[model samples]
Target: MSPANPFTRRKDRIDELAATAASPSGGIAEAGAVDEKPGVSLIASAWSRLKRSPVFLLGAGITLVFVVLALVSPLIAPHDPAAGLLLDQVRPQSNPVPGPQDGFPLGADSRGRDLLSRLLVGSQQTLIVGVFATITGLAGGLSLGILAGAFGGWVDALVMRVVDVMLSIPSLLLAFSIAAVAARPSQVTVIIAVAAVQVPVFARLLRGSMLAQRSSDHVVAARALGVTERAIVFRHMLPNSLAPVIVQSTLVLAVSIIDAAALSFLGLGNPNDRQPEWGQMLGRAQTYIYDYPHLAIYPALCIIVVALGFTLMGESLREALDPKSRR
Candidate 1:
C-alpha cells in the first residue's frame, strides 16, 4: 500500500495540536471554577463567626447608635447647643414644665443652654477627637514598632528606649505639660496630646506582636524563598500582627477619650467657651455644683456614657479577637 501523503500527515498533526490546546483550556476553566468555591466558603465562615459573637454584636450596636446620634444632632436636637436663653435657664426639675419652652425633658444649664443639645453636639467633638487621635497613634506607633521588630540591633534599641522613657512618665502629666506649653488648647492640641501619650503603648504592643509573627513558619518560609524584606514584613507579617493591634486600638480609644476629657477638665482643652465640650462643661459646672447640680451632672454623665461605650467595645473586641476564646 502507498504511504500516506505528506500533506495529509501535516493536517493530522495540526489537528492533534488544536485538540491538545482545547483540552488544557477546558481543564484550566474547570480548575478556576473549583477554586471559587473555597473562596466563597472562607467569606461565609468569617461572617458566621462574627455573627456568633454576642459581645461583638453589642459593641457594634452601641458604636452605631452613637455614630447616628452624632450625625443627626443638628436635626434632632431641640435647641441650639451654644445659644443661651437666660429667661428660661436652669428651671428646676420639679417645675411643672410641659413643653420645650419650659425645658421639661433635659434640664437647662445655668446659662440656659439645652443640656441635651450640648450633649449631642459634644458627642461629635468627642468622637472626632478620639478617632483622629487613635488613627494618628496607630499609624505612628505601628510604623515604629514594625521597624524595630523587623530589624533588630540599634534600630530596636533606639525605638524601645524612647518608648520606655515616654512610658515612665504619667500620661496625664505628660499631656498636661504639653498642653500648657501650647498657645491655647484646641481640638488639634487635644488630639496631639492624646496621640503623644498613646504612641508608646501602641508601639510596645505592636512590637511584641510583630516579633512573634516574624518568627512564625510562614514568615521564615517567605524569607527562604527570597522575597523582599519589605514585602515579607508589610504584606506577610503585617496582616497577622493586626489582630493584637485591633484589640489594643479599641482600648486606646477609650483611654484617649478619657485623657481628652481630663485635659478639658483641667482647663487645657478648647478655650472656646461656645464649643460646649463635655470636659469644658464639667469644668464650668464645678463652680455651680451646689446650686445647679444638673450642670455638673449632665456633662459628667456624657463623659461616663462615652467612656463606658468605648470601654465596652474594647473589652468585647479583645474577647472576640482572642484565638483561645474562639476555641
Candidate 2:
C-alpha cells in the first residue's frame, strides 16, 4: 500500500481520540470522575450522626446509669427498702423524718425506711412500669396502625375517629379515667392507664407514617410484583415506617414514667409500702413536704433526671433521623 500522509495519520489518531472521549468512560469526564462510594443505610447514617451529638451522648449516659442502678439495686442497696430500721429515731410530734444518719446516708422517710435504699429499689419498679407501658402502647398502636394503613376505607376511618376521640381528651385526664375504671388501683392499674393514654398517640403517628409509605416507590413496586398484601405491609411498609415510631417510643418512655409516678402520687398506684416506687415514696412524703423537704426531693430529682435523659435522647434521635438535618 502507498504510505499514508503524516497529516492523514495524525487526523486518524485525533479521530480515534475523539471517539474514545465521546464514549461513556472517556475524556475530561473520566479524568475528573471520582470513585463511587458505597451506600450508607439510613440506620447507619442516623447512628453516625447520633454518635456525634453531645445531647445524645449525655442522654445515653444518663439512661445507662439509671438502667445499671435498677438492675443492681438488690446487690448494691445498703439496707432493706421496706425495713423500718430507723423507726426508733423518728417521732411524729418531734422529728417527723430523720436526716442523714449513721448508716442512712440519705436519711429516712417518715415510715423510718432507708431513703437511699428506697430510692435505689424504686428504680426497678419505675423501669418496669415505664418499659411495660411503652411496649403495651407500641403493640396496641402497631396493630391499629397496620389495620388502618393496609385496609384503608372503613377500617381507616373507624380507627382514625377513635384515635381523634382519644386525642381530644387530655392525656393525663384520660389516664386518670382509665385508672379509675379499673377494679382497683395498683401498679398494674398504673401501667394499664399509662399505656391506654399513649396508645392514641402512637396509633396516630404510626398510621400516618404507614400511609405515607404506602405510596412510596418500593411499596408500589412490591404491589406491581404481585406481592401479597400482608407481606408488602409488614415486610416493606412497616419496616420503612418505623423510624419515627422508634424515636417516639423513647419519648413515650419519659411520659410513661411521669404518668406512672402521677398515678402513684394520686393514690392510684400500688398501695403496698413494702414495694417502694418513686411515686409511692413521693406520695408518702406529701405530709412532710413542709418540714422535711428531702423526703420528696430525692425521688422527685430521680424522676426528673431520668425523664430528661429519655427526652433528650428522643429529641436527638429525631434530629438524626430527619433527612433535613443530614449533611
Q: Which model scores highest in TM-score?
A: 2
Query: All candidates' TM-scores?
Result: 0.79, 0.91
Whole-model lDDT for model 1 versus the true structure?
A: 0.80
Global Cα RMSD, each model: 10.0, 4.0
How far out, in Å, is residue 195 in model 1? 0.6
Total clashes for model 2: 0
> In terms of lDDT, which candidate is strongest?
2
Q: Itemize residue pairs with steric clashes in candidate 1.
A: none
Task: List the global CA lDDT of all models.
Answer: 0.80, 0.92
Stretches of candidate 2 exceeding 4 Å from the true structure: 1-31, 325-327
Please provide, for model 2 over 11-34, each residue's C-alpha lDDT reduced to its tens digit, 9 standing for 90 to 100: 999999888878898775699788
Candidate 1 residue spans exceeding 4 A from truth:
1-54, 87-104, 325-327
